[model samples]
Target chain A: MRLSERELVSLIRRKLARSTASEGTIVGPGDDAAIIAPTPGEALALSTDAIVEDVHFRRRWATGFLLGLKSLLSSISDIFAMGARPRACLVSLGLSTWASPLFVEDLFEGMLKAAGRFGASIVGGNITRSNKLFIDMTVTGHLAPGNAITRAGAKVGDAIYVTGHLGGAALAAKHLFGGRIDRGRLAEVESFLRDDVAATPGDAQVELLSRFFAPPIRAEESSALAAAGICTSMIDISDGIGSDLREVCHESGVGAVIEIDSIPVFDRLPGSLAINRRDMLRLAISGGEDYELLFTVRQSDELRLQRLFQENDLCPITKIGRITPNSEGIVFLDNDGRPSEGFTGFDHFSTKEEGH
Target chain B: MRLSERELVSLIRRKLARSTASEGTIVGPGDDAAIIAPTPGEALALSTDAIVEDVHFRRRWATGFLLGLKSLLSSISDIFAMGARPRACLVSLGLSTWASPLFVEDLFEGMLKAAGRFGASIVGGNITRSNKLFIDMTVTGHLAPGNAITRAGAKVGDAIYVTGHLGGAALAAKHLFGGRIDRGRLAEVESFLRDDVAATPGDAQVELLSRFFAPPIRAEESSALAAAGICTSMIDISDGIGSDLREVCHESGVGAVIEIDSIPVFDRLPGSLAINRRDMLRLAISGGEDYELLFTVRQSDELRLQRLFQENDLCPITKIGRITPNSEGIVFLDNDGRPSEGFTGFDHFSTKEEGH
Candidate 1:
């Protein structure tokens, strides 16, 4: 049944109330605005992001719960990129007139679940009826005094690192949109993918597709890295490394030379998936929405940082490249140690057709 | 021309860079997340609100600048509703693929103007392509230690007060959206409304519409009220007094008895506007989007509060009602001291068609 704005708000309030308020929340939902107590000796980090239907994801391809989780995770990744612990989030949802109360409840449930996982509370939000569905989230976190890891801090000798494997989301997108599965059977296909991937580690297609639908956020890993004072510069790989790395380099007035052989591509796929090694490499380089933390560390601290990661049992960190002076520009070195070309990442307004 | 997300962001960054960063900003727009230094001995107040194309405003009836200003002002009003000083705002914009670069610029210009007017900085934002235009703004402010005046503070004998006149926005919306003017000539009509209303004191139609388009936010007045420790409860009249007052009463566990003749309705309106005295009173009681402050104060402190308001030279304050016990319920007394009936405020999902 259709729900009025007040009903939806009340529903959201009740659902969010289940997530216990954290220490920072002076006042939670149900007020004109939420009140949060400031953490002493800490600087607050704030980021806002939006996920629109059809632009970010097709409603038919994912459940409302997954969409809600992805929406919050995408914004939460920004806070982690700054090496801060997320304290609270405020969501602004734009729904179509035909949206059902069940849909709203499912969405809120997903959002609250994600918030609970991160130790952040859903403090407040607003809802408006629109022609299409969109979720805009604003996340606030705080870091120890003067410990923010900005994109502009990478030095010439800094080594580049990324958490977990990349390109799984891109590979998953290809299967979801490339007519491999019928829309009517999406739920069945999702179940099959989950079951098959878990049963067989080499089911590359299913594994990649599942990963795309529910990517893990690296909040704890990034926070640990920041606390250890290891990361010099950092950014979440939302836009592919090709685009994101260039952003870091541009901001830091430095360049990077990525060793192609060292790039970690998801490799457990069966031969039946039909993706060649070159295509996989391309996906790893330019595919977007990975949600993995890509950061740089001083070369001298590489071993120590690796030891720290081992001690903390954090996400496995991989070294894929090294920073260079801006004079050399961003380069991708092939197996022969020669600069390779034709690598480009996702651009919101690019006319070129995306592989996914 | 359609611009890439990168180009749009760079344009926004350049334009926003002109607004000098305040002392609270540690790192501003270019980063993944903005870092703000917390105010010591203050509690952070946060609110999020969104304005959609058709849901909030008609694109043809308003310029991008006005829409942007209204969007930010709406959220800023909430911060002020808590009697806090606005510190920063983050905007997330969703635009259609056909949106022009100039439209984006104009919108940002309006938002910046509003932010500057309230001493708040535009710290960060995100933009994406969607099916329609919408601006979701999240504002943050801070209140002095333990000074937040909440709705729960209102006592049984508290007197209800409002700033400036009410129902102007609703009356204006009636003329703007009714058959009085065509949508295509909105800009010209806006100018005419301003000039004609200014020249003639009784042009109720034009005066009401003008006020609707540009309702002044009562930030300074509410801040003064908070600083004085005089107000028992406070709220902004965005959803009209009927709904808003009920909210206060509900939260405070009290009821209210409104004196019909006490409402400060716009008096210079012409009879040609076709609103009778009773209808005007009804409009004043239930019309939405006035952006005025509705507050409650102890009857004993009424004279002192009036003196304090005069000393600050804030907006004109009017006593409109008294709080009663919850058992008494929300009552509206007519001029003859009889309980009036059949007054309902705006509901987002009501089947009844809105006049505006």
Candidate 2:
């Protein structure tokens, strides 16, 4: 049934309900905030995300169920990226006045699916009338003592490597935009978008596609990489290599040089929208929504790191760049021996006026 | 210096940088989510509230500093009202992309001042381009062992009491809106609005006007009132007596009979508004932005409650209503002995389409 945003909010409030003594909730909705006590000694890692309806998802994208899953997955991936286990999440859903009950329910169903998959609970949130459809998730997770990984640890001499293939998610998104897909084709696309492919699996080409949709590396890998004393600074190649690597340089107080020929790119992928292999590199470099981990390890451990990944049947590793002084900024050496001046990446909300 | 929303967001992000230590923060920003670990046993409390540009605050009612304080106070008030001590806060600021840096700074100053008053730290937030000014604060508060307070615990026949005076904050708000005060009049206004002016000392009324701009209620009061074994259920009167009480009754599965004459309306209250005295009752019942506590107590402990509040010099305790079966819903007992339907309260984002 069609429902106003107010009605949807009221329904959510009733369904979520207040916490009882048995629920271990000290404060629940209808208060200034909900409160919970953490198990002692654990440091909290906090994250917040805003999802604009049209920009982030399409009404025709899969079902409301898939849309919910993808929107939530987009946020959960951040928790996974932090190497922290998911804990409690507060979801703020902004419903335009004209939303429908079925639509809202389907969205919740999607969210529940993702929440269950990640083992996180929806603890508290605010539901209010909004001009646009916006869902913002404030996810809080705890870190085991000293297990949290950051982007600052990569050393200058460490070899730069990335996990997974990097263009399929964008491709999947493109396909969704183009129009309807058959069930079998959609299923294949779904599997391809899962977070594990690029994070693990050593087939160099398979891993190349993995980076495009979902990256698989976790804090455990960082622990393993760091424990072995093989890695220095690290970053996730989210906004493509060029944009993300720029952040690593800015954060680590260093610059970098990426050898275009050495950078991994997926080839021979079959999809409705066909493009040149050169464009794939550009997508790999500037095409975003890729969640792959990029890191720097000692040059000496380069061979060891490659062997480790290959032994685990993951993608073959590549040495794509070396960290340099800030004075170098970020220089990209193309296959033609041409150095590019600037990098381009996606800014989804930047182009719009802001209310999503 | 004047700054845009982007500049403001950058400042906030810089402030929060020191709070996070997670290595797994692959894509913190410029992406869909800030990925991180779900640390074990740590429960996260997420809360969000939005304040519109004009409805919530006047662009010139107070300094940008004070506006920021009000924004933070309004949101953080939710955390404290839950009996949870706030730990960190995330703000999603949606202002006209053209807002000046000075305006943004003023907002931050207000927010930081309020945070300092409550001992809560500002951690993370987002900034987006928007056509109108919208500041949404999502706060995470840490509840002590088994100590979160909700609005559902009111037992049958519990006496109701409100901390501080009612209507004074509303008075202060009205004064600020008319914009008649001069610079030298600040001290006079502050003195007149001081907490001591309430019929009783230590009443929240006088101080509330000052706090109206920023209501200061400690988390300790929850325990103090709870320890007295008098409060059955409680809520902060944000949307005025009538509406908030309706909420308390609805949550507790009961109804209430409010006496029109019994509600503590303010002295020297201006008559400038188009609405009349009866409408004033409507305002007291429904007008919002007042953060005074409304709580229920055992009938047997009514005397003790009065004495306790008196000892603390709190405003005169008044019993405006009593809880009845839900079938009664919420009724107002007029001097003519007629019962009126429910009162309308403020909904900040309500627009012409709502037909309120």
Candidate 3:
């Protein structure tokens, strides 16, 4: 299990060479740094995100392949959120001595698949020893100048919208973290994900694991939204709505008025937990890891945005709120028009440390 | 000092917003991704490197600033190794809950200083909670198309040369990790580094620590070498001559004959610890973290490369060996021309775990 760093790097290089090499690369893995040609007339978008073993995820909760896939996809999500197509990435991994070379191979295979599906070439990376396993990926993309949709453009009258299901990933995380899944079920789920035969739609455990294991892909819709010039501001819901909403509002100097009942809830949980409707609503509002695009568009462009989404087979968008003056202070009204209170953004990862 | 991730990110944004903003950035921090306008007609060189709490350096040995400075600079060295100018970087930090806000501030100050010195803008990054502190940096640089100096271009008759001192970083690391200094001296060294009063010329302790704390900056030298178009292949000496030479030789499908006596030695140790010449020679060849440039130039271009360095007052280069056909293998010869045996690459960081 004590594989040399050189061997791991060689393995990664071989996997990438066979699968992830793109034309713009002048030099790929095995160099001091990867050299890539920037597309003519396009700017580059850069982002970095890391998955520390216990911080972002627990290894036992998913297979190595699923873990690798999610780690790369999460970073790639940033590029898509910027309305850019991911082109290349550098993955820095810190593997403990207990990890097998096969684990490294499986991990890279997952990353290769994710990059290939998203069109990002595996360009360069570093391998080193650590007491804990961590995957830090930096992904870059091509974007036309001045075309990025940032989180600082929300206007007072713009309507707030989100693509895809909300709070499902968080709910999935809750079941796992809340210790609802037994060891036997965990093994089965991990095996399914490891074998990539995860299509058992009727199994509640597999269904729940899939949501956290694989958030819906949002790159195409983000590109479409940016191209249409309809979204005034955009952000991905990696953190729950409460946190993401605060970011946009704070940056844009705006407040928001959200309709609690209008917000689309991801209620596809695996089993009957007897959770009340109010609890489900709160989960929808506070859960993180959704990877869904949350954006705003001027009222006039709302129709055009809707038509564009309709034309393409993209995730449907829901109008959950509208931007308001900064003085209003992000007000949210319940279905009865009463102020919805005390639902703060829930950062599940930061709340507790898993005892290893 | 369990500051929220939000507050830490806000601190980073404020620091970067005040100091590191570059013109090409359409969006900087506080966004999902940073958008940078790639320099016209230039390819990009991307690299990542990380420093974990105990794996890379002990906090008692150096202040947060030096740790931050070295971490970022080491990554930037890769861009230079490719003969590119550092442009922008994303830093992903995993901080423990007990870490203070002041530590975070000082850390970024160190990174900002390095980035500022090397002309790289702090574009985007993520701050997350971790059981131990780690800083992972991904740096991108600009290089003219087809101008990158890769490690796969060396050929037979190519002269192997290196810039700057070698083995000094490993020697310094040995001193600190071997417990050469007590708590009082460790505190003093940390204070000296924390205050950035690093210019004590004659203090051996300070000098020894300086070598490890602040690696030699080689961006300008690398750019000059690449621009000169003399080096047939190049690599940064992060893992000492032995490991790096293996990289170039393996990639280029060639071998090398090195005169061990001719290799540059970073012999400016603070004071002698009764180390023999043979051991010092081995350390010089096997020690990692030198961050020097090990490269090859054709016999025909050697004079021109030497002339270019002399004209620019650049760090002097030494001709240590010549590339051989793969059948010759990578052989090292001592001053007596006898076959030098058993001086393999020394990977210090990967050798032992530092007990926290």
Candidate 4:
């Protein structure tokens, strides 16, 4: 479900399985987000992504440091989803002619800060001249052997749990539409846009905007859970619960049922960002960029999970749904247990011109 | 030196030294093309490069499969330069809308073929929509303990040797100038380019073009030389002897003297690609992408190197130069043993839109 990828996915999956490069590769592509193994006792996870200007982000919307930090953080989110600890990263910068030395340094500063946070470093990378600024990043992480939580392991009776909150990044992004601003006024108008957004129900302008600027880091919690052998299936919520949830279900060959009333709408962080119940509900379900861990656990181990979180003082996790048979499909129940509609996730392809 | 890069180089070099994340790092940036260590007995080399449409290559000139092949071959060439055998690679594709699924599959075919040649495989990567097709690849290679042949080990009195021939790829490139072709006439005109090129000097259009498509494989020779401990320093001839030789001297605190007459002009492979003596000399010294290993051997090991190659039945290598004191600089001597002029390597930054 990364990039909501098409075509080449299945083709690469079938062809790459037979070709083993290393002696200790426990997992290859198609099922896991990465592939590698240092020893039979340990596994290495590698994932790569190319974030382009306008397509993924806009230079006018965030500082170079924030962009660099976010680029690395969002990429490593997959490593965490696979229940691994980030070790190193390689960044390929496609800089345009107008880019300056100071700007490049700022970009590195952001990446270094993020990498340092998780004991990761920028090992090596390449740079190229391109029409638009592109940050292509590859992150390598390590995990205990047999602990890789692929998206294909969820069982029908598993209880689904989501960590932290969601919907703030999507709301912050809504403030900026499909339009271009004056180049010189980019910085000044960015502040103005923040102020405009602050005038709305989301009074914590800085906090909400941060959701769009950087992804929430969850490696520690994820690794602990993985080491404890808890998660059945897992995926990072980059494209929201709706799109991401569908991915987990499809991969696991199962269906899910969500209790809408149990979902945390992410309002208490800074007060209600949602102006109405409908807006809040839709954002909670379909607004992407939460970067939280959406995972499944055995029904019998629910009490153990609660005790683990409490004992470890980990971030609060909520049981939002349960896994169901594949024929049942993904269902959402209202307070009256009735079905609902109007769920829409971010479509990267259609939003080609839109950047936030 | 990878891109004939600019300002940000030294800045990154100084900052990244203190930020070690892994416990097993034998080397880091500013010295080697890659950075990693799998165990005390073996090292893992990780290097990345981003090749963009038009900026690095032209879609109109070559088919997707060849582009993919060339892209991978060039990147892994760095691994061989560091005295390692490729084990795996992760490719991040930024696909433009015009790119079809068929084109992507062809790309994978090329990469898979190149990877399989060295027992390597395509492991994992991500794809995204972009304004142009960009392949950002990271190659991981392995080598014996303490066999790393970085560019910083050369000393005065070391003999310089180059693998295979030079200038054919550059000469073939000379047939292509800065120009655009009709989109629909691309495939037809590409054959025309080869035909037009064949009519002039290089009769082996297919062979000359192959030099530009797939880089000369030298991992076997490089690894053997490094394992034998005959090389004091080594580098791949990516940006021609002038630029790449300068890099070796600058890093090792030594200089070099190239015997112009000793350089094989790469004619015997399929016939002379160079038109005249002037173009021949210039192409041999300046036009890049030969991808041959340029290594320094101690004067004492010269006989041993000869015996090793002769005994192992390896590719022919020619000794074309000798290392000198730092004050000597990089000098080129003609047949009469006089200093020569008129050498200019490819400037990747200036020819931004000129794809070939």
Best by TM-score: 3
Task: Return whichever of 1 and 4 wins on DockQ.
Answer: 1
The numbered model that scores best in DockQ is 1
Residues A1-356, model 2: lDDT tens digits:
25533455566655444222213344554555666555467556676766655555545444545556555655665555545566666777665655566767766666655665655656677765556566777766655545555566556666678765665555545555556445555444345444332234344333333333233434345445544556665655545787678766766778888887777765546544556766777777776666666778778878888777766565445678898877877788987778965445544335222112
User: How do all models score by TM-score?
Assistant: 0.91, 0.79, 0.94, 0.82
Order the numbered candidates by DockQ, best leading: 1, 3, 2, 4
TM-score of 1: 0.91
Q: Each candidate: what lDDT?
A: 0.79, 0.59, 0.80, 0.68
Q: For candidate 3, lDDT tens digit of each residue in A264-339?
A: 8776665554355677667667777888889999999999988999999777899999999999988779888888
Task: Find the 10 residues in a row with the least total lDDT in model 4 chain B.
Answer: B1-10
Estimate candidate 1's alpha-carbon lDDT, on a 0 to 1 scale. 0.79
Error of 1 at A356 (Å): 8.3
Give lDDT tens digits, candidate 3, residues B1-356. 45666777887788888784787887888898998898999999899988887777776665667677788878888889889899998999887765688888878887887788876889989877677788899999998887899999999999999987677777777777776766666556556655653344356666666667677777778888878888899988887788899999999999999999898877666555436667777776777788888999999998899888999988878999999999999999988998899787745335433521
Docking quality class, candidate 3:
medium
Model 4 Cα lDDT, one tens digit per residue, B1-356: 11111122223333333332234332233210122335434555667877899776766665776677778888888888878777667778787776665667667766666676666666556666778789999887666646777787899999999998898777655654333323333344334433432123333655666666666778779878978988988888876887678778877899999998898777744443337766766776778878888899999999999999989898799999999999999899989999988664555555212553
Worst 10 residues of 2 chain B by lDDT: B193-202
i-RMS, every candidate?
1.4, 5.0, 1.9, 13.8
- Candidate 4 residue spans exceeding 4 A from truth: A1-41, A176-203, A268-274, A350-353, B1-41, B176-203, B268-274, B350-353
Model 2, CA-based lDDT: 0.59
After superposing candidate 3, which stretches have Cα over 4 Å from the reference? A182-204, A272-274, A348-356, B182-200, B272-274, B348-356
Where is the poorest 10-residue window by lDDT in model 3 chain A? A347-356
Q: Could you tell me the interface RMSD of model 1? A: 1.4
Q: Candidate 2: lDDT of A137?
A: 74
